[model samples]
Target: MAPAGPDHGGSGTPEPDTGTQRRLARRLVALQSAHEFAEEIVLWPAVLRHCPAGDALVTTALEQERQLKRTLEELAHISPGSQEFTQCVNTLAGLNRTHLTYEENQVWPRLQDGLTARDTVRLARQWSGARRRAPTRPHPRLAARPVVLGTVGLAVAVVDRTRDGLTAR
Candidate 1:
């Protein structure tokens, strides 16, 4: 993810503050979590039901997401001013970029192959709803299961949004 700040004149200079890094990290986690959670709840099931190679594809994506989630949680403990924190963030950016590209290039096609225009539209709506209701922080345990993802995710989203409102985040 692009670190939050002014777009320096393509000089490749990073924002020189921990606060910005922290905010960027949190934002990335929230976005990635929402996207992954939506896939887990909506697209993956459809993939398995329709695509011949769905199991393998979804498994790889799941592993990537699991690793990314773990790394994201670890980021919360790192001092963003440190070199290690920068390295970790860079790693996450690369991983997230790769995952997104793969989803678009591979998983999306498979998911869309059998879907009608109306079905696609419906799925899009559901996906957006899922993202909106998804938690803004890592919850690996709750995220592991579908039942918990639906019920607990809703609860956590409420709490998270409330906290965000109070914190002005």
Candidate 2:
């Protein structure tokens, strides 16, 4: 299924219950929470013990998360058809891209150097437990690609319908 994003235009017709949207939202939240847990509970401690660079990386990631959360909250208020919603979605996507790049390029490698296999497993367990206890609302858009794509698909469908109405005039 297409990932959700602001760019997803809606159909002029009633919105169909695309299980994709809800699933994407849920997964996005789960992924973000898991990533955060891994860093805070597992990676940071290991990095502090072994890799000094981990400190800077974790700090940067946390700041980004804070900003992303704000943007997501704003986007949630604006309906998919609104310009504000699109802008927020775009911002979110950009943030996600940058964050993922940073993690994949710098943070993950540093974490590997700092953490042993046993540490990783222990951290993973902690993350799982945290996720189970985390609240359901306000799922963070952790990664931009999947969520944005899905949202964009829906947004585009909406836009197309609007355009069709104008053209039909």
Which candidate ranks first by lDDT, i.e. highest?
A: 1
Residues 1-169 of candidate 1 have per-residue lDDT tens digits of 6654458445566567878878887787778777778777777777777778988988888888887877787786788788889888888888888888988998888878878899889888888888888777766666555677788777887887788789887
lDDT of each candidate versus the true structure: 0.79, 0.56
Ten contiguous residues minimizing lDDT sum, candidate 2: 137-146
- Model 2 per-residue lDDT tens digits across residues 7-92: 45543444534454434544454455434533444445555666666567767877776676666556545555445655766887
Q: Model 2 compared with the native: what TM-score? A: 0.58
TM-score, each model? 0.82, 0.58
Global Cα lDDT for candidate 1: 0.79
RMSD of each: 6.1, 14.4
Point to the candidate with the largest TM-score. 1
